[model samples]
Target: MIPPSSCGVLVVGSGNAGFSAAISAAQSGAGSVLLIDKCPESWTGGNSYFTAGAYRIAHDGLASILPLVSNVSSEQAERIDLEPYTEADFARDMRTVCGGRSDPELSRVLVEDSGDAVRWLARNGVRFWLSFNRQAYEVDGRTKFWGGLCLRTPDGGKSLIADLQASAAQHGVTTSFSTALVDLRYQGSDGVVATVRCDDGRRHEITARAVILAAGGFEASPSLRSQYLGPGWDMAYVRGTPYNTGDVLELAVRSLGAQTFGNWSSCHSVAWDASASTDPNAGDREASNEYTKSGYPLGLMLNAEGQRFVDEGVDLRNYTYAKFGRAILSQPGHLAFQVWDSQTSGMLRAEEYRPERAEHITGRTIEELAKACADKGLLDAEAFVRTVHEYNEAVYAHRRENPSARFDPSMKDGLSTQSSGKRLSLAKSNWALPLDQGPFLAVKVTCGVTFTFGGLRVDPQTAQLLSPGGGKIPRVYCCGEMLGGLFYGNYPGGSGLTSGTVFGRRAGRAAAAAAAAVEEEGDLVRS
Candidate 1:
């Protein structure tokens, strides 16, 4: 709890970014740091707890990356063929994924500081392990880890949140859960103070020298989703916290004159199980990120009309999954089914097989699978079978032309169907395999929005929220999903957590410095 009088620094939200700011501020010599969040302490980590805990960082090779993991067996280590992910590769991927519209300044900090930032997290007691199940494929007795995403915090987001909370407590930063920010009271001579809505439904005035708003975006508000993200967005299921109704973003913009940047229509959404719950307080950790159907690249997506609507293999799933949600939402009925044969069923993440959470069906043949999907009102039985047959013929034709080519899931191995008149409007550019294997599976999916891309703009150097006139908000800094401009049309996998840590560190240090400056100048005395 914050002292009734005042504090040196105040950090709002207890997610990775908020905790990062609080810990950093305390380390920077802030006398009193208070961390506040609207969620109860038991469920207070924000959407950070819903993450898979993947952190994308630039590393030379396995030798440089292996140390970050808390544990690794010699057998598992020796079988891994990990490649280098350089800073250039990270930058290129970020730009290419977002079509070059990513904020240059913010993206630079994310890419350049990602390595050290993750290391810093580990040093502060967050444990990580190679995301073996998500990032690796066992090929020829060797486990090959592809994509820039390799490390994940132990037990995924749950562990990451727990550890960060423990670390914050150890650093002498007081935390108050179920405390919502009512408003910011700015006194010209004394700087900014905040009015908070405490757990007991009473409002309290809290004074602080500096405040950092790491609160998240407006993904939870249906009306805001429709107004800002455009038509059909209100129906989208929220993948994380429901408390992130954009109150902080609105406060910073309308009340504090913060500049809003990034594409309002763009967001970090994913292909989520259609039956997933919409409640943020839904205590089902399995229903969190596990509901995501991210293995589309290894399979095909069929719309309600039994037609392919996207080039599922246009790129690695990491680069393409975020945008696929919008595509699914655009499909008829805002639904789609990801279909895969037995050849690749084992290839999907373990989450897909979770009986309690996944909406999956199995059939002995394509014909049977199509019928089963039809029974569930997911597709037209005949049309789906016809589509499968045509796709198979194309796959066979392509294989005959290049007999030596093979299907490799770890990378795009030119496993494509032949260009023919029967080709659907959208085609799978890579990893296109015939659904001839028995016991084929299909999982119904819809869009699950993770976070909004639009938020209060901030200076990359100091992490201070920027005004519309291009000036800092002085003592107020911003981080996490609240700090927009890094992402726009699309997102690179694992970059969210990396960004939270990077900007969180900068914002924490800056807020602490601002507090020290006020005290040193004797302009406004600290209580």
Candidate 2:
């Protein structure tokens, strides 16, 4: 409930990045910081509230990260086989996933500052735990954490928002919900003036010495999706907040001449429940990220035509899941079915695959499963069964040649269909175990867009929005999904939240310093 008058720093959006900037600004002695969001207080955290809150950081194995988490017991720690994730490893993933097009400067900052940013978040109020359920596998009574992702907020993004909000309030930052930023302009010596519309339809202008925009991308806007992300994207279900319609981002570019960067045609999408609500505004708040069916890496995905459209085991789930949504969308009906035998059904994450959270179809045999999938809109029942049989045959042939090869999800075991003399048009690169075990489970999925990869370009060091002319915009900073060029085609799991924290902290500090400098200049004039 702040008056539409003046403040030292103004922040748009109330998600993790916004709160990170607000709290950082307040802590840095920026007086009268105000945070505003277009949605009501119920929709406070924006898309961040729907995330797994995973943070990927470079560390020295279990010993380096053990101090930052609260979930690992002394006995549990001893049995954990955690490997160190260095900056080089992180950078290599960024390059490989993005096809070597990720901005080197932004990637460097995100990787180098990730550890310190995570530690800073811990120093504030955010709590982290080992991502045991999502990133580890138990082999021989020992937990082996795979994929460089190890830490996540307990209970996922909900707890992340709660902790960040608490920290912001403690730091004297005020929040105003249902306050949408309509326009932004720099007034030179008078600072940045933002025109905002309140829920009551009242419009007013607020002046701030420095302004930070962290309002997220335009993934929720169907028009923008169809326009930028290409055809059929308008039908993609949104996995996060519908309120992030790119209002502030558009405002920045239109009014401030902010430079746009990165791949507008790609986004952080995933395999989502086909039964989930299609209405962008109607995302199940309780279900949140649980709608994601990421168990494909452990099994196979067939399109409506009953053909394998992707190499499900091409890489770890962290590396492949983001781009697979586009693959799923390109299929016949923009839908696919993930099938797993009894052998790997238990490996699926309970939070995502529990019957209460997701719809599951089971059958006693491959033929029965195919029939059931046909009932659920599969185009060809016979092809579905044939595909399964062919996959099983390939797996068996590979195993016969290389009996030493074993299916281990903890690492990229060389157990692949390609190892066999016979080959299918598409091959499972890893975790290729014959799916001949008893009853099988299948889940229907479609594309659920998480966020856009394209956004305003910002300086990697200060997070200040880069003007089209190749300079920083005066006193304006940007972070989170609104600042682009770090991710292009795909991103490693858990890097989004870490990148947000890194640049959010940078933008906050830079905005606060700008505000202080403005105040000092005014003080000198008065003196």
For model 2, the run of ten residues with the poorest summed lDDT: 276-285
Residue-level lDDT of model 2, residues 258-326, one tens digit each, is 999988889999999988875654477898899999999889999999999999988899998888998
What are the RMSD figures for all models against the true structure? 1.9, 1.0
- State each model's CA lDDT, in order: 0.86, 0.91
Residue 105 in model 1: shift from native, Å?
A: 1.4
The top-ranked prediction according to lDDT is 2
Clashing pairs in 2: none
For candidate 1, give the lDDT of residue 403: 80
Q: lDDT of candidate 2 vs native?
A: 0.91
